[model samples]
Target chain A: MENQVTRVVFYVSDGTAITAEAIGHAVLSQYPVSLTQHILPFVETVERAREIRTRIDEIYARSGRRPLVFYSIVAAEVREQIVASQGFCQDILAALVSPLQEELGVPPQSTLRRTHGLTKHNFERYDARIAAIDYTLAHDDGMSLRQLDQAEAILLGVSRCGKTPTSLYLAMQFGIRAVNYPFIADDMDVLALPPGLRPHHDKLFGLTIDPERLAVIREERRSGSLYASLRQCRLEITEVEALYRRHGIPHLNTTNHSVEEISTKVIEMLGLERRMF
Target chain B: MENQVTRVVFYVSDGTAITAEAIGHAVLSQYPVSLTQHILPFVETVERAREIRTRIDEIYARSGRRPLVFYSIVAAEVREQIVASQGFCQDILAALVSPLQEELGVPPQSTLRRTHGLTKHNFERYDARIAAIDYTLAHDDGMSLRQLDQAEAILLGVSRCGKTPTSLYLAMQFGIRAVNYPFIADDMDVLALPPGLRPHHDKLFGLTIDPERLAVIREERRSGSLYASLRQCRLEITEVEALYRRHGIPHLNTTNHSVEEISTKVIEMLGLERRMF
Candidate 1:
């Protein structure tokens, strides 16, 4: 058997640690290694930083291998503690920031920064994002049709075809007010666009899935039922896809795409404004 | 008046441009510049790449300044097109990946990478994330108490105290099954832990907000109503906070925190497993 190398990886941040984790994951995905991951977020205090440092040192002492640390810290004191650790520490944001700074010919604003933190300037945009989430939940799975006009994008698909997650993602990630309506087993016979959605035809997007994949997903939800049977899955997909073609709606197959991919594609296809919060 | 530098920024990627946007946003936040942003995802084909190159060149010609492009493309031909554009381009992932590669002593797997794409290997984890989203929605706003035992975390807070969005974020981002219950005005008079939740006290987390901020948020939902009044907001906050203290529930103030911050804090405080999907 081939020897597989293992490493302990830590994603540490003074704030949410989301960016640290994101960049670290992307970077590490390129290498072939097994990772035991630890995420340490909100390490703002010097005391917490020392504790993390000690933890890293102990892991190094026990394993005889320096753990990898990917971190972003705004505070000098807190950052210093992590830098002192017995680990292969990488400042996730500093590399990119320095190049951009040189390019822009300006010194970085020397202050505590919060990449994922909410501030007075961004509070309004943040509120809009929350409101979008509210609007999305209310309109999920055809729950409410009263305010279809307010929706930026309306998703049409059969049940378990990946509409709810995609709608919520659009709202959560981009602050887009998204509405998703599912075509159920009952609606399979006559899968037509609802009258309310007709007025918002331009906002309509569709999602379809392969029958084999659909059956597997449905089987997990309802085992040994007709809903999970391949034949029914095939029929639903066929009818729903035909409906999409008849309506001239831009659609995507959800069988292979992740929620992020689906949401980004939907936004791009519909030309929806991608508001960054 | 001092001349303020304004730049056009583009985030391009062969996959979902989420990572590019995230790193770019974090890096740009350090600089004092006004940015006009464009995000182009799935720039796989040479045709799309060429089209984007032209668009970048056109913007440069019109503005008499080079645009800043932050991109991550896997294909050599496609990446070459973007690199050849008349923009100051930066490979967002390459900077960090190279240093890490030297440290790990391994070359990167030279394959088309998708940071946000779903694959057969990660399909199960991806499914669990979707399931977490499903679980969170079903349990949102105290919708279902049947599965309290299955919940990873239970959030208790007053209305609009940043519960639903946080719960969804916990699920969507970390695949943690989160349930949020609101303490409404009706419950204030007889405020006590619901008998159903008492069994799962270890899983309980409280969210409180400043009365003044609470009033503002409530006002947006229903202006000039008693529910949105300062007095009501104060009373509800006081009662819920006391309940948190009395029950020994670990809690946080959501007044100044974003959903990302709140969710990260909650996970850290509870020592919940942070699963990266």
Candidate 2:
């Protein structure tokens, strides 16, 4: 606080504040300013807004800088109360509501917690995601070979190539039925696909990593192990890439990719539709 | 497509297009119109944007309804090309950029794919998330009681009270080290906390569900068992509530709550900060 000029930022919302935080983080990432953020959720009442306003004022008094407030409060009076505080208050819901009202030819509902609702009508969507999650957890690491047929995409990669996390993310986030099979020592020796995966060639997506990076990742888990050796990593990666090329399996280098990036690339390459939003 | 006027909607971006899709879905949920969605990710080049433009025109020509394009494309020319497409184009990045630039008194770096980059410096963040995921998975269902000390939060609930998914979601989405411990028959008989969880009572959050709903959920897993009986469910839920009250553990009824809602509420109640955005 002494050397760096830190500004207080609040993601204020009447609901979970996910939308506010999403828009706030995206907006704030552009700025080259150090920020300390507070999530003030369930600020539904004017009194609560005023309390937050007073807190912001206190911060402003100490720092001699106006705090930045990003809010998605649906209530007009409550939003106004927060705006009255000493800060640049950006109302995400207000910006969205007007544009949406005009576009939809109707005024927006000023209700709280419109997002993340699971009603009876939307139960199937919830159930589908749960089913996908169950399927992913059950079939992880080629555990259930028979269930491979039901997978939207079967991810094949060496250990620590990020198959498990990516598979779970694909299932949980998008409700995509993803099953991952790790290319172990036995499987990597032969240049042929495993018997279980041979039938699902069209649904297979390969994840490859730099041998150096793979070695480093594995070394973190089990140092001095044969599997974590750079030489072993190089051999396995080379063999896996050759197999991918030989089989015409679409693959992506995941050495520098996040799970989001890997999942997106797999979805794009395979053109897998997201089962749920 | 016939009864409901179907409009083609594209969530377009140079990177994952996740932000575009999230905001698009939130905005479009207000409208009652049925939508046909296409995720045209990695639309980095003007050529790719133009190709998407052609596809939008084709859809518009066939459906006689202008397509909706929600984009987070950072490149000006690429975004312009998408805007020229036959649709009502909404630029999420543009809406965010100008306001943020004005507030911060600095123009944002119009760099493509800024969100999901995995550089050396950012590896710690990724590693933290992976570690949390591993911790959550290992400590799930009290599989390893010795590892309970490592967990940031311990979720205690009756069987099928939405513990596993919530824990996984928290770990994956927020990088929170969450472990769920279910109250089995032996543990529930005595009005005392498990010996393993006694020291970590402060970290425990209880989840209760409607007896009828709990019975239904248990029935789906294993039908006609004593565990799935309504009377048993009522007894268990009653005892769980009494335990929560006696132990002063914060609890939430997850009868009608989605995982998102339940997780959000738990975080709010416990004042748990998300390790990642």
Candidate 3:
């Protein structure tokens, strides 16, 4: 209940809420502290500053705690004006730097001190959602596993057969964006390749490791479950491979190959056009 | 015993062992899995190939496991020559691309899979270590905490104090090399800052958040220990701030600053040059 207050506020250039949000997300990642962030942009007015302060007050009152309020867009002139205006106190709402230095015990030159400021002031221009989507596409996490439209190719595999990690490796090591789907027992029923996969089947590839290895990995996750049984895993793999064969899906057995090895083999096996460097 | 024996053998170009060790010390990261890479320069002789292969063999034999062996300097012809002369097969050995694909379910692009291959192929001319270090500097764990000499600055703080992530935002946005160092209690006791740090106090910046907020984070991590003790943390912070004030350490209390706010303050406070557009 005490943790429900906002502690940080991110300021950005005019009309850059999304940029501030992205940076806020990035900032939240470093420390494990609990606090919410309020986005205040285009802080050219005392009215906006007072509004932000009021909002902070409401958050504290509702949560029965005064949350840490951060100000990202607090400019020099704005600070001067706010001091004269009602409800804004300059003493409590200092910049974030002094505290961080005191916390880390870093001397003046420790690059750690300048890390965030440099990134925010000097970062790539945040293109709108379209570009963000593109970046995410180029760096897909392989969760949906559904057919990838933008993907030049797709990979189908059994769990722990190394699908998500491999897809990421492909995207990063090379610029070729790849999408992967795990072959769960649920997917075993998905005998027919989804419609989105048909156009890219020639570019599509499948990977399977030994059933014993698959069982070993599954066991690590669930110790004793129908999901981890060797017999079911073997059958699932066998069925998936047959489905791939029936549908003319190019397949590889990744028994001993590392993720890098398989990626190379897929390129060699499928003769797919180079999507990455 | 078994896990210790068969450590992965990764062969790359030079001087990256420090980076490799830093990265490989972890089991698997969000990016590339860091293994004990045996970086080898390109060798032209059959005897050298044999020597390298024998060393690789001993690494595997001692580990009692077939660690993912990644050979980075391999050229197309070099791969062919190594295979032809040393009779290395896929069952035991793997080049960067092929093995990685197998490991990750990624399709390997045969071009520039090796370390030197990456160096040669990268339009950016530098050694493999430098290339990897640069790439990692920007995108390690998809987080940007600039570590190399390239970083222009850093942000330091306690857990949830927003250091690593903020640095990344700056780097990605500004193209500035930013790193973050978490300040531990030991850092305070040392009386002096770490080497390479004393001279850069002019560039040093800090971020501090509210103690109650920090307490919430500590509670999440330790729940019931001295970590969650508000009194103890308050004392630590008071002492740290005293030290900062004693040394004229200019820092910002992130207690009320959003990441953007904190970053902007850093820029203003340190008069740092911006790297991003």
Candidate 4:
């Protein structure tokens, strides 16, 4: 809100909004809580499309400063529509993906990753492989923890910092073995990693989000319960973070970040080898 | 390849393998495909836990005596590693998803719905507003489209039989606002769903799949290109089901399906009735 001047990075893709979301999500990471954010929908229809322009002007007029508008797509009409707005700056989405344009792109890549007819077969092999691994792991009698030894990373977080999906994401994208351990009361509250898990500290990566956000997530899973209570969420988060602090564990707060951002941070933190596009 | 075994159904929590892949894949789903399939992962696990063991055991050996394993948290070491030889199984990894249980069955209730703390001035305003709208449609922009207006039931068919992901399966699960579209062409051909795609029918659903299994998808994408060459995949899949025939539209094949699945399918197809949950 400083200078009544807003600097916002909008990710506009000439392709599907999915790409836009990824890029937008990535960009959000570059800035912490300091930046104000607004993500408007796919700019379709002249009316729905024109709203951004007016809003920018309104913001500009109200603040007496130019508004920063990041345009995510490459549609000429969409671009034109966005540009017509007075005092609004337009930033192209794709270009912002990376300095190495060709490197960070998917095909049908130019327009969008044409995701039509993605056969179940293609999905099966990869998915089944993952599920198969999941199956084998699920079936493994804990007599052996050796399989997880080679894991590139392990995620530690209270019950819902999105560790499972993030772990699977790491496995899927980087082909790295990732394991997540939930912070249940028996363990998280006691400020002690489960005895079975304490040995893996060297590979552990912690994920923490705003307790408020955690409460929101819990509410979605089970509303109106002590489990989902914000009061409970705050207490747990504070307890966990304090334990993490005492244990010298480095953690990332996932509030206001996408899974990609969180994963990227984990990869960066773990110094994992980059994933092939 | 086993004696008297023509088909196999694997119930997985992720659902990627059994439904997206096993339903109609190459290495897994082929002429050998037989039997009515049920890949309900935790449903059986929960049922089994609730003394539904007979039901689960029956399902496992249901492939006319060959046995179909309904694996889940049933076998996780988290629960002291229940042991059952020659019956349904489980392991640790798959147990991760058990936390999501209360959200699905018995009428869509999300565990994340009730927690408070997000009531910070900004959080509550936005959260409450979005909570009032359709969760599916409100959570994200509902950015991708498959003829929302004319869509009867969107078919979310990835290549091969990802159709189950988009059509029958989704419809059966959520109940409304379904649409599906297919992606064709491979890494080369520049054709995806035609321009001005006001699907002659109602809302449009989409299907995509894993790329590794999309030899036919490669064919559809490039039609005889080196990548799509049956010689490459060494299978008659391409000739067996042309792209349009399988997915019901000329689409832009996206071999790797990730974001599109979560946002597009979750929002457009399922159309979660309310946002709070």
Among these predicted structures, which one has the highest DockQ? 1
Candidate 2 per-residue C-alpha lDDT over A1-277 given as tens digits, one digit per residue, 9 for 90 to 100: 2554477898888766766777777767666678898987778899999999999999889988888888776688998989898987887645544565555455544454356666666766787887888889888888887767688989998998999889988998889999888889777666578776888888999999999988988898999999999999999999999999999999999978888888889998998886544
How does chain B score by TM in each prediction?
Answer: 0.97, 0.93, 0.45, 0.28
lDDT of 1 by residue, B1-277 (tens): 1566999999999988998999999889888888999999999999999999999999999988899999999888999999999999999888778877777888998787678879778879999999999999999999999888789999999999999999999999999999999888999998999999999988999999999988988899999999999999999999999999988999999878988899998998998998876
Sort all candidates by DockQ, best to worst.
1, 2, 4, 3
Q: Which stretches of candidate 1 lie over 4 Å from their true place?
A: none
Off by over 4 Å in 3: A1-147, A272-277, B1-277
**Docking quality class, candidate 2:** medium
Candidate no. 2 TM-score: 0.94
* Ten-residue region with minimum lDDT total, candidate 4 chain A: A99-108
DockQ of candidate model 4: 0.03
Which stretches of candidate 2 lie above 4 Å from their native place?
A1-5, B1-6
Which candidate achieves the best lDDT against the true structure?
Answer: 1
Against the true structure, what is every candidate's RMSD? 1.3, 2.4, 25.7, 21.9
Provide TM-scores for the models: 0.98, 0.94, 0.33, 0.39
* Positional deviation of residue B121's Cα in model 2 after best superposition, in angstroms: 2.2
For candidate 1, the docking band is: high
Cα displacement (Å) at residue A220, model 1: 1.2
> Candidate 2: what lDDT?
0.81
